[model samples]
Target: MIEENRFPVIETDRLNLRQVTKDDAESILAYLSDQDVMKHYGLEPFDSIDDALDEIAWYQAIFEKKTGIRWGITLKEQGRIIGSCGFLNIVSEHRRSEIGFELSKEYWGNGMASEALESVITYGFEQLNLQRVQALIEPPNISSQRLVERKGFIREGLLRNYEFTCGKFDDLLMYSLLKQDYEKMSYST
Candidate 1:
């Protein structure tokens, strides 16, 4: 089972990740509504503030149910939300989970995603005792693929017509990182 206290305030030199709240609706909507941001994410671009609110509610419920978690990624320097990242399809019995993330388009290529993802990945391996972490990305999202690969996740395979989003069936490039490998990398770093 996932630890009840899995929801943690994770911090890095330039970022802070915390629980998503209803109060974050506006900031979250900023990116959730952008086509460039939600293109690969399962849901359609959030059409209104209510869409963000509904998703936030869903995010909270999933954590409460011990099924998943979504961290609101905040940029400390600006003191505003710039993105979100977390695990879904978490199966503690199998010691594995799927990871997902998206940042505001304006903040792309700034290394913030790396900072946020590292904190979450470490938390999975160390605190949550997760044995494997996986990322399923749309085949066309080169940046996301590179981000996970840079962190040492290996491309596992491809899932064709894996998800139907944005009015069509989308393919996903599966990436995985094992806890043992992550530990080895951590020690080396």
Candidate 2:
């Protein structure tokens, strides 16, 4: 069952996924303001620390509403956040939620995203008792596409013009990992 009163902190070999606090606003703004990093993030690059504060507020709101949880990804050696990842749009009745994540460009290609994703997926299926975790990726975001595929998320189909963001309609590819599939992959590995 999902924890309703406390945020869960997940630790991996090299990373710590913890609750995002107001103090993290500056770090969050640093990456969220980067044009390259925000390219596929749907929203435009953040302009001020207020944007980051708003994001942190959203994180808190989602948790309070019991609709989602997002973790700030920090290095084990350095406690500052370098990225964030988690499940959103959770529907307990349906046992499903959407998974999303983003990392600082400096940390790209370091396998951190994959590591974090594995932990989050495990928590979703095992701890949250979710049956399905889905991801929506833009067609041009090849790295994200590969990341989810490597984690055994099957391509469901294209969501044509599904989101109108940054002044344009964008197509998103829908992918999902079922609990059964996760268990199979777990046993195989």
Candidate 3:
């Protein structure tokens, strides 16, 4: 079984992956409500600040229950939350999980997502003993698809009409990396 309580924080070279909390409402609102960030993700603009606050509370509750791990990605130099990243839909028995992430528009093209995902993928394999890690990217999200590919995740296939978002069904592309592949890359580097 995965021990969710054993690890709380993961540090990357330029970012700190810390647990999401209700107090993060303000910071999360800064990006979560941005229309640019939510556009291709099939989410509507946050109608009110209260919506962001409630979302943070919901994430905190999920963290407390050991259902998933969410992190506020804070830049080390400024100590400001520029993004969020984490594992979702963890299935311990199957030794697999889905990964999700988002960054403030300002941080785009800076390789922050790639850096953070590398660190988190390492943690999932080495610390959590997961056998596989996967990312589901909407087809039009070319940036995210490139990020996953750059991380050495192979394109598995497409899940047709896999999710309903932005008023209609959307297709998803699945990409995955195995524990063995990660280990090989680690040793090679």
Candidate 4:
């Protein structure tokens, strides 16, 4: 079972993945409010700080419930959140979870998301002993699709109109990385 007593902090060469705090509301709002960043995020841009606060609260709720963990992505030199990534809907018995992430537009093509995602995935497999890590991506999110593909997540199938967000139902592509697959990847590297 995944531990809920302490939040794990993951660090890479350029980024730190730590718990999201109320103080990060403004930063969270900065990107989450941007239409381009939130385009495939399944929600409308947040217009108020309260919306960001609600998001932080949801992060807390999921952690407390042992259902998910979201880490704020920050630079080691400047510790303000630039984005976030984590696993959600964890099913311990099944050893599976859903992965999600987003970054500020300013940081989009700099490989920050990939760095944070790699750390999160390693924790999910190594610490949580998760057997399967999956991602549900909107078909139009080509960048995200490419990122996960590079990480070895195989496209399972397209879930036609799988989710309803921002007014209408949208198609989502289901992708997964199994433990055996991850093991093979680790060996190849």
The digit string of per-residue lDDT tens for model 1 on 14-68 reads 8989988888899999998999898778888998999999989988887988878
Please, what is the whole-model Cα lDDT of each candidate in the order they appear?
Answer: 0.87, 0.94, 0.81, 0.93
Which is the leading candidate under lDDT? 2
Clashing residue pairs in candidate 2 are none
39-79: candidate 2 lDDT, tens digit per residue:
99999999999999999999999988989999999999999
Q: Candidate 2: list runs displaced more than 4 Å.
A: 187-189
Point out the worst 10-residue segment of candidate 4 by lDDT.
180-189
Q: Supply candidate 2's per-residue lDDT for 55.
A: 96
Give the deviation of candidate 2 from the true structure as CA RMSD: 1.3
Those runs of model 4 whose alpha carbons end farther than 4 Å from true positions after fitting are: 186-189
**All candidates in order of lDDT, best leading:** 2, 4, 1, 3
Per-residue lDDT value at 189 in model 1: 31
Candidate 1, residue 164: Cα displacement in angstroms equals 1.9
State, as a TM-score between 0 and 1, how close model 1 is to the true structure.
0.94
Q: Which regions of candidate 1 deviate over 4 angstroms?
A: 186-189
**How many steric clashes between backbone atoms does each model show?**
0, 0, 0, 0
lDDT of 3 by residue, 80-103 (tens): 777888777778879898888899
